[model samples]
Target chain A: MTTTQDRQSAGVEITPLTAPAQRTANTAFRGLSITAASLILVTLAAVATFLLVEAWPAITDASGELADKVSWIRPDEGQSLIEIAGYLIFGTVLISAIALLIATPLSIGIALFISHYAPRKLASGLGYLIDLLAAIPSVVYGLWGAIVLIPVLQPFYQWLADYLGWIPLFAPADDGTVSNTGRVALSAGIVLAIMVIPIITAVTREVFLQTPKLHEEAALAMGATRWEMVRMAVFPFGRSGIIGATMLGLGRALGETMAVYMILSVGLTYSFQILNAANHNTIASYIAGQFPEANSQGVSALIALGLALFVITLLVNMLARWIVSRRSEFSGAN
Target chain B: MSKRIDVNNLNVYYGGFLAVEDVSLSIEAKSVTAFIGPSGCGKSTFLRTLNRMHEVIPGARVEGEVLMDGVNLYDPQVDPVAVRRHVGMVFQRPNPFPTMSIEENVLAGVKLNSKRMSKSDSQDLVESSLRGANLWEEVKDRLDKPGSSLSGGQQQRLCIARAIAIKPDVLLMDEPCSALDPISTLAIEDLIQELKSEYTIVIVTHNMQQAARVSEKTAFFNIAGTGKPGKLIEMDDTTTIFSAPAEKATEDYISGRFG
Candidate 1:
């Protein structure tokens, strides 16, 4: 009461609800924050527009003068830009798919081991070690894959072709031999798998750690063994999170360039013999290897290939969001 | 299926600190027993020791004998997991597995162990368990919906159904209705009255009225000060404890004269 009377005596009045406040630190921070956020969207739109404008002629003018000069893309057959993109899309997807299949289960195992099995004193240290794998440069991985990993895998590839030659995937090329050099799609995919494990493991470890305590107790109180309890509560709770993490890894693998280009013995073969040098090549590596020697038309074709990769990555991201969101709505804690 | 419990020289510890010290008590089979105490008195801790649930927390251990039907649950040959199976538990909050449908939630105790059940047998079991918890009428049609879609009261009852589905000999409740409304508490109290005829029911509660209303026997626990272990102070019939407690501290706590 004294304060109110003092305020009235001092001729102070409450501000109206609609009255605007004077400029303050809050307004400045909010302005800067919104600008930074919107800048990302604006930059994304600008890049997409630029790619679309630059790649239009190469994509539309299939038999024009520029498309004629866009050699090294089936020069004898005169394949259009869309056809070449479609061909490269297969290799990009095949490599990332292999990476996803190998990385997803390994990441899940490492995450669970870190989150549930490791002792409290050692778990944090193991987690930091896993995250450190992501910090290694891709070029270093490329060098290691080419120099050290290839010789170790060459005998193994030869053994697979010798023992499992009847299977079409391990069957030799039409020239009648496997890659004694081990610079095959299988090795490139394995290298990509090693590179993306940290990404998937990081997201999945945090999700597994966030499994609700009450739910875990509820399962354990039911006499569930430790693994059973994890299967019952932790796995279901982290399912959508696992899917999202795998998609992130897949996106990273799809756009990877230096390691794949450095390690791959680039050749196009439709037989899908993964243990051979003459196999499909990813769009990123194709562009990376060819960009320096490319003309104006060749550059546009490469940008168009990049646009295809961007579309594929966008689709995978959308699919991840759809699955995660749909799962949360259907059965997650409403 | 109810069985009596005999606890002798029970001491619960978290790491090196004793939480509940040297308690001895016998609970009658087929009746409701309530443990009442001030906050941090370890009533809930002692309750967890009954089913070996406290060991889920690392370094939490108990030194004592918890005998159910003349068998020592703490014996080296006995598995804690088997003990929990025979002694079911319900927590304060209603925690039906959110990812499961109502029917699946009821059968989780059996299914999560990977035991096989025929389709018809599981259906019958679901009906009987939900009926046993008095929730069949409300949720009969939507057993396919997620367990989390229910109201708080309904979810608590679903947890009760889940607990009873395993056909345990004893049921341990740790402040099961503390997070519920008065009407829901009454509903649970009435359910407890119904359940005590079939299973040995031990509950820890803060509300004296709830203890008086639902339990036949009451035990009072107290702590002298912070950092001191909680001890069981008195045990008697509910009427005797409320109206004429033998211990002065019990009388003070019952009569609202507590410090």
Candidate 2:
């Protein structure tokens, strides 16, 4: 206030370059933007710190009753939190890997169909429907997976067990008794695959559409068929983009809880039998299913599981970022 | 493999609009012909029609016939893709596949079509094509580098190499040097001289001096007004067209008069 009055009394502004009034406005905006940007970093740090604090007791075995009635979650005496986390991660990685394997190719094919094959009007309508698919609530997907998808996949699982039992991953039971229900990891994986398709497809379609026209024309001028041109120009240019999109889908798949929790009959066995009803458990679905009935220590242990999941997803996203940035080095020159 | 092209009453259209109307000209084999005109005069469109490339545009089509070695290119039995395989093109801008290295970019036409060749054959073809484009010496040590890593001039030459690797009979250049600097333009002009010994060359250029220098024969195209179809005003030996043009529009365009 004093400074303003003093400057007014001087009867002149700093007329050299930047105006004093504009500088003040600039400073205020700079502060506002800085605070807005720092809020994300600060919130991230706070969440990480809180997770560490809460999970420390379970990790160090300070919290008694870590192994309560739910021995499946905490395991036997003195089993380190790392081992529990490893089991959860294994399950999480297994189901999402299956989902990714199923989703990525399907998404790429669908993206290509929309971008290159379909008529323009039909393509737009199809794209809109896919985007709408992406917007459907996860809880709704959970319900659909439980009531609709699981029952539909039961016959398929039995057929796999009947003919393809030699593949250890698809084996139903040693006694050859076919499970009546489809509440298995394989079913959960397919549900997750369906969930991530729209997300991966939408991203890859955008990237494919952004392919440089000059390159496409070059290929066509050289007598390439449409498929060949897409192979030469579209696929190569959109490689990193597809990988990044798949990673985003993977991130969502790994952290997805409601869909998996509803579809899966969870158990903590180390069996790789995906067709079996009670073999493995993704960390997220496990947490969701067990959190409500958990003791204080049990909840702490679950948070530790969440921390492990957080680290894995963070690594996935970072790997995606690195891949995208690496492509830009050569990408920008063109 | 060089072949003469005879275009008869060619009319190019984009949907309902005629772009270039009733252009009939003979392009000699193993010689360079230049098409020169102002912007939007359809010189580039007429050039693309020789190789059926104008049809690549949606709703853009051609009427009448373009004959190469007595085969009508616009015939119902003629496949456009097969036509393009024999008649390659270089655009106004340099476009090398960014994802491919120099060696892959050189072999892109063959490799993308899944053609199988032994190691030695591919190595020889890459060498010969790059040499033909006058780019082998500068890029020999870095065949593994991405094509996008090359300078603008070198990338254009790489594109030329890719086009010729398919062994097309007629090569069409649409303002190939417009995007290049003067020195690079000279380099390409010199290249067009050597390339014409084995391939029929047709170029569309906005620069009169470039057309005068590089072409054996020159064709001038003109439009009456905007949205009107362009017509070929005159075509003659490069020396005669520049010295004593027959058409008033040709003389006017050549002498800095109203075109």
**Which candidate leads the pack in DockQ?**
1
User: How big is the positional error of residue B43 in model 2, measured in Å on the Cα after superposition?
Assistant: 1.8
lDDT of 2 by residue, A305-330 (tens): 88889889999999888887875745
lDDT tens digits, residues B1-259, model 1?
9999999999999999999999999999999999999999999999999999999999999998999999999999999998889999999998898988899999999886577999999999999999999899999999998999988989999999999999999999999998999888888899999999999999999999999999999999999999999999989999999999999999999888873
Model 1, stretches more than 4 Å misplaced? A1-3, A6-23, A174-177, A330-333
Residue A323, candidate 1: alpha-carbon lDDT: 84
Give lDDT per model, in order.
0.90, 0.89
What's the residue-level lDDT of B7 in candidate 2?
91
Tens digits of per-residue lDDT for model 1, A54-141: 8786777745566568666665675566666776798888888878889999999999999999988798998999999999999999
lDDT of 1 at B108: 96
* Candidate 1 clash figure, as a count: 0
Clashing pairs in 1: none
Model 1 TM-score, 2 decimals: 0.95
